[model samples]
Target: MKKLLQIIIGLGFILTPFYTNAHVKWFTEVAPKKESIENILSPLFMGLALLAAVVLASLTIIIPKMAQMPLIKKWDDYLSGFRKYSRYLLKYGTAVALIIQVTNGTLFAPEFQLDSTLLTVLAWVTIGLLLVPHHIATKLGASILLILFIMVTVKHGIFYMLDYGFYVAIIGVLLVGSTKLENVGFPFLYLGTGLSLCWVAVEKWVYPTMSLDIVANHQVPTFGFEPAAFIVMAAFVEFVVGYLLVVGILNRVLGFVVTTIFILTTMLFGFTEIIGHFMIHIVLIIFIIEGVSFYNPPIKMHKTRVDQFIFIFLNFIFVLSTFVLIYYRFA
Candidate 1:
């Protein structure tokens, strides 16, 4: 009954603003012709959002049960071996990158439509340096490259480089055989994700205009509710979710749920449509890593009723936000 009540409340939150439809203008995007709503919101985005909600809801319900199942526990043992394999793959990956660098420069030129620029050349050079007979020089070269890469990532806007920088850094770690460092990376990983998510929610809130416009012009509605209300709701939900994510509260479940939404987002927005599907794959990798963490659970994280309440509350908020956005756009 408690869970049912929570779901009901969440549905209500999602559905109420949907009836108002006062903020369709928020979703519009400026285009070459003019501000076309169609240009702002695509079917892919909408479908992805809906699909994410569904998948998250399912996972939230199922994963716990799976955790309890004897078969699932056995399966996790086999899955654990992948981490060791991942370490081996990382070493070989440098070789692959080396091959690609050579091929890209020699065979696939500008004529071949591959980017064979200075950075590509440098990347290959570093890879070769890592392969030398001298372990000290190899490790030193790789470490320097890793440091340079991190410096570049931090110096630039976190949002601009975060996605790609994260992938590169992860690859570097794997290549260098830093499994021990995974312990150190865990807290920072949580901190970074939490901060990013919180910031995203805040950005949408502050610039409700951009996010809301995307909703309106794209023809995604808020269950017939006024646009302003929906925008407010969205801002609030994102803020709350972001806060929770950053603080590392309810991280496991939230991580799973958020990943689902991100996956849907990639499918709808076009991995290549936004920044390229590469980031999407990176996100998937992050999700997998998180799943592995949960399975092995190097650290023990205890849950409280407060955590459950927050999860249910946030879920409710998104449900209402979605329903409202849809109702206004359609009905």
Candidate 2:
């Protein structure tokens, strides 16, 4: 058990900078286009849109009510017993995500591949360390990841790298890896994800063109809205959900919904989406079951409503203006 703890700690380090690969729509690696709502709507599309809204509304009303049923509650209680395995999931999943990224030659983007064969090889080594399932090996993996992330950051600059969202996964790895801090790993992971979602949303805000390309290419079904509006609204949803995760609000429902969305996306986009969002899927799974922490995490995080609001506001500005300014100045 002690050795396992060490492995977990080491695994944490391996997750340092989880940049979305060049083709990944979830984390970054962007797309979408500018077909206006005014231009695209027809009677059939309008009917479909209304049907979608009705279905969404119905599900919103129904699923939670069903979740509270005795059988469902019993099942949830049963699942709670196995939540401990999420520890392994977090560690191994990170390794696999790294493997996918390395194999693809981009962080998560097949389009934005690394030029250096050496870095590619090093990424494989990181995967090997994650698979070791021991602290010492995991530590080695983390160390390697740290170096990789740092190198990437230096080249990309501190201001506006979409890869920065990887910090949450890093925190999860370290927290769960530590004997002293393992219990709080889930919360910190949630915080990291929240921050990541908001940060990625900024990418859409600044680079709407990238989002437009994605929406159009994916045939993501914008209902009657302009593709660009859909992209912006999608970013908002991403930001709010991340905020909710960070603030520990409606965590289970949000997690479950997000996980379902990712699953649907994987089906839509196939193997690349699977590779790109593997880590995200694991974290959401954890959130769906774990919901929040077993302990107070991040050392004095969110003790009150005011604290949550303050965090939400500050993070919003940080993700929005901070990145936008960097983009205008640097890129």
Candidate 3:
């Protein structure tokens, strides 16, 4: 067991440099070109997909037992104590992200510039409401944030705005946090953000050229793999992160690793990286603090190890195929 933990940690250290969370579309001018279906279904892609499914399924089965270890349990308990502050962290962190966007003349992300004066004013108003310290004010702030999102959708099509779906989830978190159903907010947050990330990972497969272009433009290290292969591995890494979030596995540990990877990217991508991922960083911190306290993860329902493994393996394949095919068809 100790050896297994060491191997996982070692692999994480090796892969950390390649695990980029920056949305390629935000950094590159993506052409309308799509990867050939043949390439999408290549041996390499399918093999990696299967490998990822097996690895994640194994984690889903193993992580519960690992969590019961004296050291892990103690650390998790310490982190779980901060669950009460999850809402505050999300709220204020979003406030800071909005402030950065407003100052930079953008909306939800750096790519979507503020195209009109109304959006600029609304952005400021949303920030003000977020700062007001009252539940009503925060709800109003979330409402305005929704309005801003809709406005962006109107300007750009729904397809473009889907990349920012996590913002909608954030708004949901804020709105629900003030209601009697506040407990549901975190699970909703988890679902929305997780699905959003999974959706975005599809883009890397469908539009590999964009990611490859970003790698070339930014001189990102590939660590000896071809750029294409690296992108595949990177996308898989991101998809697994999102999947674990949805299933509530390794909440704090995943949060810590992903947060570290994002911070490392800033050294390569600079202020733009920080601006693009600031809200994500905040949400990860919340994950580290909350550690699945309010939710019963799906994998936990299967009592036997064999049942859990089968459930995770099949579930991963279904989700991966569904997402890839749907995104390809749309693209």
Model 1 lDDT tens row, 1-331: 5543543364334222112111212124532122234432345434444554444334444566667778766655544544433332334334443454345442111111224365555566666765664545455655655654555455554443432333454444543444455454434434444444444343343345665556655555467766756655554444444444333333334554554444443332321222222222333334333443532221123255444444544564464354334333432
TM-score of 2: 0.69
- Report residue 111 deviation for candidate 1 (angstroms): 24
- lDDT score for residue 84 of model 2: 70
- Per-candidate clashes come to 46, 25, 0
Q: What tens digits encode model 2's per-residue C-alpha lDDT throughout 207-247?
A: 66776766677676788998866765666556566655654
When sorted by TM-score, best at the front, the candidate numbers are 3, 2, 1
For candidate 3, the 10 contiguous residues with the lowest summed lDDT are 11-20
Worst 10 residues of 2 by lDDT: 14-23
Q: Which residue ranges in model 2 land beyond 4 Å of their true spot?
A: 1-72, 108-112, 295-331
Off by over 4 Å in 3: 1-20
The whole-model lDDT of each prediction reads 0.42, 0.59, 0.81
Model 1: per-residue Cα lDDT at residue 119:
50
Candidate 3 lDDT tens digits, 150-251: 988998888777777888889998998767988888887888788878888888988999999989999988899999999998888888888888877756
The full ranking of all candidates by lDDT, starting with the best, is: 3, 2, 1
Runs in model 1 lying further than 4 Å from the true structure: 1-66, 69-81, 85-176, 179-182, 220-257, 271-277, 289-331
Compute the lDDT for candidate 1.
Answer: 0.42
